[model samples]
Target: MATIKDVARVAKVSVGTVSRVLNGSSKISPESYKAVHDAARQLGYRRNAVAQALVSKTSKMFGVLVSDVGVPFFGEMVKGIEEVARQKGLHLLICNGYHDATEEKNMIEYLLSHRCQSLVVHSKGLSDEELIQYSREIPGMIVINRYIDAIKERCVFLNNHQGMHIAVSRLLDSHNGVAYIGSSEDIQDATDRYLGYQKALEDRSIEFNEQWVVHCEPVAEAGYKAIKQLAEQGELPSSIVTYNDALASGVLDYLHGEGIKIPEQVSVVGFDDIELARYLYPKLTTVRYPIREMAEFAANLSIQLLEDATPSVSDEELEFVPKLIERNSAVI
Candidate 1:
C-alpha cells in the first residue's frame, strides 16, 4: 500500500526526487538514488504503471482482445504476444469476448478505458465498419484473422480460401469422393473455407452434392455428430475434410468406435494443426494455421506503431498461408 509519497517520506527526500530516481533520470545524484532504492526496498513500494503513464502521456500496456482465452488456440496467441511484451518491459491487458458481439465491444472499450494505445484484436462478431471506425480512432490497433480493405494495412490475416483450396486439392488427387465438415459459425472464415472447398472441386469438374456436406459448430462434439450424420444419411465418404482440428478429432473418434481403419477405409484432413493433432491416435493430417507466429507478427506490428516508426509491411507480408501437414490420418 506504499505510494510515491510514502517512498519519499521514508527516504527523507522530496517526491520529485523519488520520481526522478525511479524514472531512471541521469540528473539524480548517486546518494539520492541509493536513498530512494533503500527506502523503496524497505517500504516494498512498487511503481504504478498507470500513474507513470499519466506523467509520460503514453501507455505502458498492450491490450489483446480474443474470442476466448480458455481455448488452446488463443492460449498460443497470448504466448506469442507475451514474448514481445516481455522484451519491451510492457504488460498485457487480456480480455475475452467469448465470440459475442456485445461482449467484444465492451472488452475493446474496457481496454481503451485503461489507456491501452496498442491493441491486437481477434474479433469475430464486430462488423467491418465498426472495426474500421475503431482502427481510425486507435492507430495502433491490429486486426488478426480478418481483413478489411479500408484498414488492410493494420490487418494480419490468413488466406483461408487459398488454404482450403490447397487442402481439398490434395485430397481430390487421391480420392474422387470427398466430404466436407464445415463450421456453422457466421464468420467470414467459415464462408471462405467452404467456398475454397467447392472451388477446388469445381476446378476438377466434380459435381457438388448437398448430402456430402455437414455444417456444425467448430468443436469436437460437432465433428463427431457431423460424422454420425454422414454415416446415417447413407455411408461415410472415403475422404473427409474438416473446418478445424477439433471437429476432425471427433471424426477420428467416431470412426475408431465404428472399427473403421484410417487412411485405408477412410481418410480425414483437418485444418489448424493444433498440438492435440499430434497426440491423437493416428496423428492428424492438418493444415498448419501458424496462429502463434501470426500473433507475434501482429504484436510486433502494434508495438512498432506505438513505440517506434511503423514498419513498411506489404499486403503479402501481413497475409499468411496455411501448409498441409501429411500425417498418418490420411492417404490415398
Candidate 2:
C-alpha cells in the first residue's frame, strides 16, 4: 500500500527523484538511488503501473491475439512472445478467439480500450483496412500467421507451400499415391497447403486424382469422417497428409480400428509438429513450424514500431519456412 509519495517522504527526496529511480533513469545520483531503494524496501513500496502509464502515455502492456490458445502451436508461440516481453520488462495480455472473427474483433476493441502499447495479432479475423486504421491510431501493431495489404505491418508467418512440398515429396518418394485431409476451399492456409500438395504431385510426375483428395474441417472428427467417406468411395490413397497433428491422430485411430496398418498399409504425414507428435504410439512425421521464433520476432518488432519513428517493415508479405521432421508415422 506504500505509494511513491510515501517513499519520497521517507527518503527525504522529491517525488520526481523517486519516479526517476523507479524508471531506472540515469539522471539520479548514487546517494539518491541508495536512499530511495532503502526507503522503498522499508515502506514495502511498489511502482504503480497504471499511474506511470497515465503520466508517460504508455501502458507498458502488449496484446496477443491467437486463433486458439489450446493448440500446441499457439502455446509455443505464446511462450516465445512471453519470453521477449519479460526480457523487455513488459506484460502480455493473451486473447483466444477460437478462430472466430467476431470474437477477435471484440478482443481487439477490449485491448485498445485498456491502452495496450502494441498488438500482436496471429489470426485471420480482421480485414486489412481495419487493421491499418488501428495501427494508424495505436502505438504499433504486428500481424502473425496472416497478412494484411493496407497496413505496412510486420508479419511473421509460415511457409505453408514449402511445408506441404516436403510432406508430399516424402509421401511420393516412399509411396505411390497420397491423399490430403484438411479444410476445403474456404480457409486460405488449407487451400495453400492443398496447392502445395498438388505442386509436389506435378513435380514428381504423379497424376492428380480428385477422388483421392478429401476436404474436412481442421478437427479430429473431421478426419475420422473424411476417412470413413473415403473408405466407402473405394478411393483411399496409399498415404495421407493432414493439415495438422490433431486430424492425423484421428486418421491413425480410424485406420487402426478398421484393421488397417499405418505406414505399412497407408503412410501418414501431419503439419505443425505439436508436442503430441512425440508422445503418440507411432511418432508423427510433421512440419516443424518456427512458432517461437515467429512469435518473438513479431513481439519485438511490434515494440520497435511503437518506440521508434520508423516503421517495422515496409513490405507487405513476410513468411517463415517450415522444416520437415521425419518420424515414425510416414514411410521412411
What TM-score would each prediction reach against the true structure? 0.83, 0.78
Q: Per-residue CA lDDT of candidate 1, range 247-329, in tens?
A: 99999999999999998999999998989999998999999999999999999999787655467898889999899999999
Model 2: CA > 4 A from native: 1-58, 149-153, 311-318
Tell me the lDDT of model 1 at 106: 82
Flag regions of model 1 displaced more than 4 Å. 1-58, 308-310
lDDT of 2 by residue, 224-275 (tens): 8888888889957789999888888889889989988877888888898888
| N/CA/C clash count, model 1 | 0
Q: Which pairs in model 2 have colliding backbones?
A: none
Go through the candidates in order and give the clash count of each.
Answer: 0, 0
Cα RMSDs, all models: 9.9, 11.2
